[model samples]
Target: MHPVLFEVIGLPISPYGLLIALGMLTGIWVAKRRGRAIGIPEEAVYDTVFWGVLLGFVGARIAFVLVNFGAFLRDPLPLVFSREGFVFLGGFLAALPVIAVVLRRWRVRYLAMADLLAPSLALAHAFGRMGCFFAGCCYGGVCDRPWAVRFPRIIDWRRGPVDLAEAEFTPGGAIYHGVDRVGDVVGSPAFYDQVKHGQLDWSDTASLAVHPVQLYDVAIQLGLFALLSWMWWRRRTLHGQIFLLYLWLYAASRIVLELFRGDLERGLWFGGWVSTSQLISGGLIVVALGLTLQRRRLFAPASEPAAAPRDPGDA
Candidate 1:
């Protein structure tokens, strides 16, 4: 995969980082526009997102490090500065409390703020998954389908994948461990697996065709974004319904998607029967259900309360 989108002034720019930045900026722009309609100050929205993003990055990085602790210990500097390895759930969990604090200090309704951010979160995640696809990270299990994608070899020698390309020299002063038979080769855990299982030979140019799970994740997130946006603008009745729905739906989808994931870097337990994301998603599903039930109790049908103030400036 084309990890480096391009070079600027002799420096490489990674597609993963660029796409994530683009997603964040787009999410912020959309949030600012929607925030105004619901009486949320633009400045408040900006402040909330800023702190959330800053903390989210740190949390994601920390989670990545913890998950790959042995590798981090062996090579700490590269791991710390690497553009890849961020976990979405970790960042999301870390950002929630800070977001809540900002909303409370700004005198904003928590549910309203949650609703406003829900679609934006899905939108951003869809873009981030697209970035993952470009970087060949979060890859999917092998598939015989016509749409399966065979990822390109890792050109960087530091990562330790077979270099099938007939390169005159190797990068980082690392010895070329590839056979002289010139051919294309796949990269990473896929390469390692193929070699171990005899699925790949030195003559191969790419990994075995596999399911494009990252694209599937992107599609799911976009669909969620569309549904949440529609609910936000048209069918929103209860204040917290959209946010709760987002949580429930995404958690459910993630459980299914994790089944197709090929990468083993994400933690697994119970003899690989349960993944970390799957376990987390299961808990989130229960939490969403409970919160939704509790939220519904606040709007009893027997004694309908007055309509909420259109402007929640002091809410």
Candidate 2:
């Protein structure tokens, strides 16, 4: 996982930031193409996208800061200036109003536009999660097994320093270091040697093994995108149905994935059993279901009497 892509002279460029920008560009291009194919005006799509991107960024930053208020208070400048963490739900919520207003101003049908944008959103998320992987921030829990990777750079203060030596050395008729036999390095020559070797250390309180939630999200979003595309192409018969389906599907997948995420600052309902995201996902599911039912009822066809074409005779 290369965080810094390269250095030009003394300046460093972060790969994560670059990948995010690339994702945005790809999303915009996809949306434009989809809009054109669907007979939506290119200018209208651009206008809506501009507003959506702005609001999305603002919403993502705000949500991240609010969730980690304690950390932000300690480092205000980084919280305000750095573009590290982002919450997709926050951005989606903020962009909803912007998209609605744009659609209203242009006299466009909100449901049709939503259908066009759904796939683009999912593709954008796929790339964003890939960026997270490269940045090495959203890492998984530790395991000694083969599939379990050791992030050498990840330090834990509680564990002190890990000694790779097979045995501990005793000092002057007393046992010193390696007493716990649980990778805890107390005062010992081996510990000092590890420090000299530049091995990273961190607090033992930190969870070492965690699920790689980012990859899980990427898979779910990509699947959703495929499903949405199929629905959009096949079922343009009913307006807003595709969008409703998208909301329901994504919310359900997100709720499932939230179970694997261990970084939420606030636990919901149960003691450390539920997360804030799960609660939000539940709300989204309910709203999506209601919308789906409402759309079905509203778009249902009703019989009407045929009218005689006697306009010419009347005239």
lDDT (10s digit) by residue, model 2, range 1-315: 444566569655666688778877887887788776656777777888889989999998787677667656654555566546677788888899989988776656777778778887887888888777655444443334444433332212244334333223222211121111222222322222233233323222223444566677778878887888787677666656667777888888888777655443433457767666677778899898787668757542112111112334432
- Backbone clash count, each prediction separately: 2, 15
Local distance difference test, per candidate? 0.74, 0.61
Which tens-of-lDDT digit does each residue in 1-315 have in candidate 1?
666666689766777789999998899899899877767778888888899999999988887777667556655665577667788888988998998888767766767777888999999999999998887778888899998998754455224345443233233212121111112222444544454356776356677888899999999999999999998888878777788899999999999999998766577789988888898899999999788778767523312221233455654
- Which segments of model 1 are wrong by more than 4 Å? 156-189, 192-203, 298-315
User: TM-scores for all candidates?
Assistant: 0.83, 0.74
Model 2 global lDDT (CA atoms, 0 to 1):
0.61
Q: Which regions of candidate 2 fall more than 4 Å away from where they truly are?
A: 8-11, 141-146, 154-209, 264-269, 298-315
Could you tell me the TM-score of candidate 2?
0.74
